[model samples]
Target: MVFLDEPTTGLDPDARQEFWKLVSSLKQQGCSVLLTTHYMDEAQRLCDRLLLLLQGQVIDQGTPEELIERTVGDEVVEIAGIDELQLQGLTRQADTWYRPFGDGYVVALPTQRSLLWEQLGSLQPQRLTRRRANLEDVFLHLTGKVLQ
Candidate 1:
């Protein structure tokens, strides 16, 4: 077994790639790896299973995809320059969940909702985009929008 905690934190990209290759080789040789990191990309890439911690407590644990799907729903819509209060009534009517993000808010839209599109269009946010959810979404969903 091998233990690494933020092992690639200060490595340049090339060195990080090299480190990952070395770890992959070790795994192929039947070595088990235990690692701790704040880098979501690293966790998603290297871990078969992951535990998410907030405030020194385990918040969720699962394969990355499972965590994302279970916590963040299917789709994310990011809209900037919109007030949370302004969207509250619409969001309630539309079947979407909204949380403040950097300079704006991200609304988690369920894939099954066809009416949400029309509701969003009516609001005409300064910017809006649809995307699939990932680990960051899961983190924000489970831990909330607050930085602390």
Candidate 2:
């Protein structure tokens, strides 16, 4: 049995890819694999079944598609800058939250940041953060960003 609790937290894409292949092989051999992850892409591509845990309790559970449809059925946008100065003014009208990134910000939005995008419509950002259902979105929703 192999238990993975966020095994790819800091692993690069190549490493995560290799780790996934190994886990997939174990599942092929009929090994009972139990795991916990905030990464939706990993669970979607790897697990036969997934259980989402929060504060030591099981909330709603389902496949990535199911969970995403139920919670976040909106387009996502990601914007990165030296700081969230533009993010602060542009995001005041929509639902948004700041997820800390080293020396900057990684924002996740359940709604589109049209206002913000228009403001920076010309100034291309260093990075763009979308509401795509990855590990971060799953954990954000689970942790209750909007619910907060």
Candidate 3:
């Protein structure tokens, strides 16, 4: 068994890739590897399961995809340049999850994009992007959004 704590923390991207390859090789050789990393991409790439920790407590545990789907849902929409009033209005809508991010908000939903479009699209945001949910989304959802 091997335990690696932020093993690739300071490595360049290319070096990180190489390190991950080595970790993959270890998995192939049937070695148990316990890895801890703040980099969600690394965890998603290499781990078959993940343990989500916050404030020194285990908040959730599952396959990365399972975790993401369970917590943040299927899709996330990012809208830039929204005001606090708009945020409050959006929050009051039925069945939605949202969080404020830099100069914008990240909204998640399992369905009802058209409904959201009807409500928020009229605002004509500076930038609006829709993407599939990811581990970071799950982390932020399960844990508090406030920076520690």
Using all chains and alpha carbons, the TM-scores for the candidates as numbered come to 0.84, 0.57, 0.89
Candidate 2 structure quality by residue, lDDT tens digits, 100-132: 445545454545434654554445777665555
**Residue-level lDDT for 132 in candidate 2:** 58
Better of 2 and 3 by TM-score: 3
Best by the TM-score measure: 3
On TM-score, who's better, 1 or 2? 1
- Sorted on TM-score, best first, the list reads 3, 1, 2
Report the poorest 10 consecutive residues by lDDT, candidate 3: 109-118
What is candidate 1's CA lDDT for residue 85?
69
Task: Give the better candidate number (1 or 2) by lDDT.
Answer: 1
lDDT of 3 by residue, 1-148 (tens): 9999999988999999999999999999999999999998889889999999988999999999889878877888888876757755675573666787667778775464447755667778887888888887787777866311
The order of the candidates by lDDT, greatest first, is 1, 3, 2
lDDT of 1 by residue, 1-148 (tens): 9999999999999999999888888889999999898888788888889999999999999999899888777888888866566667667766567788787787777667567756776677788888888888788778885321
